[model samples]
Target chain A: MEQIGLSHIAITTGILLILTGLWGILTQKNIIKMIIGFSLFDTGIHIVMVGVGYVEGKTAPILDEAVQLKEAARQIVDPLPQAMVLTAIVIGIGITALMLAYALRLYQKNKTLDIQKFNDLKW
Target chain B: MIIKIIAIIIGLAILLMALIAVYNKKLIVAIVAAGVVSLFASVMYLLLSAPDVAMTEAAIGSGLSTIIFFYVVNKIRKNRKDHA
Candidate 1:
């Protein structure tokens, strides 16, 4: 009971984070604010991924003295999600940077940050 | 037991800060609050036993992203001042 509760708490937190980020993205008017919201969403997803991969009594996936070779397969927590998250984090940074660059260029072109004002594509 | 409590507390803090970041009237305040959310999230990552993810979140999400945001804000402010 206790063990299940721990992971449950973490997973719930992740869901809350995602909801907050989504709310920000939907309601905010500024481009930069939307970017910040996107980052938050990315972080929330990563947290959930890590939370889902967690094991109750297992250690990290590092092979060492405490986690011997033969028992490692059973004793170690899942490593695949962690590896994917690392890549995702870096990609998140790149995407944020790219979005910021777009914001800068848009500001230079239109001299405004309000999303409604830049509706050239709107029909 | 204690660890669970701590995680819950931190998670609540993250949610609160995120709300502040999204709804604050001041853009700078919103940006800073977002940075705080990222910092707390890195701590949550640590609790989840992904030291590598924690480190990445701390460095990229909290630190570099905030710096980039501030830089862009400053640039826009300076441009507006010059034009005004």
Candidate 2:
């Protein structure tokens, strides 16, 4: 059997977190709770990205005096996922803020955070 | 060897905290629990040799996001108080 490594552990944790967050989003009645779930989901995705990019026995993507240019690619983990996750994190925060703003507006209209209270769409 | 063990523990802790965030009865506790999950995930990122991601997660997840969540919660509570 292969030994456990950082990637294995991170990937597992990320997937579990995604599941937990999905449960929160699906079952939660409060809008705030759903927003929390969204945050969890976002974090989980980022973790997975970093995990997938991780290379065994590699240092961080940054190039410093310790590593030579020719060996930099072999010495460091992939930088692509890190870059993607960085952008995603910013977008996630923006989306979260937008959701919270919407929640506040909805609460103002109905004086309730409960999703069931706004039933205008019902026929 | 030791890093793997630490990762396992961190993973378990994140899972438990996430469950609490999802299932807990109290809103404040749930929010705090979610913040802890972010902090742990950041640590996990560091273990994965993604220091850049780890720093961003630590700053945004544990700091900015928590503050935003708390602000929203406080606003809702204050509004509720006014309505009642």
Query: Best by lDDT, which number?
Result: 2
Best by TM-score: 2
Score every model by TM-score.
0.95, 0.96
Winning candidate number (DockQ)? 2
Name every residue pair that clashes in candidate 1. none
Error of 2 at A30 (Å): 0.8
Local accuracy of candidate 1 as per-residue lDDT tens digits, A59-112 = 778887889898888998888999999999899989998999999999999999
Tens-digit per-residue lDDT, A12-82, candidate 2: 89998999899999999999899899899988989988999899879988888867899997899999999
Docking class of 1: medium
**In candidate 2, which residue ranges exceed 4 Å CA deviation?**
none
Candidate 1 lDDT by residue in tens digits, B1-41? 77788888998999899889888988899999989998998
Question: Candidate 2 falls in which docking quality class?
Answer: high
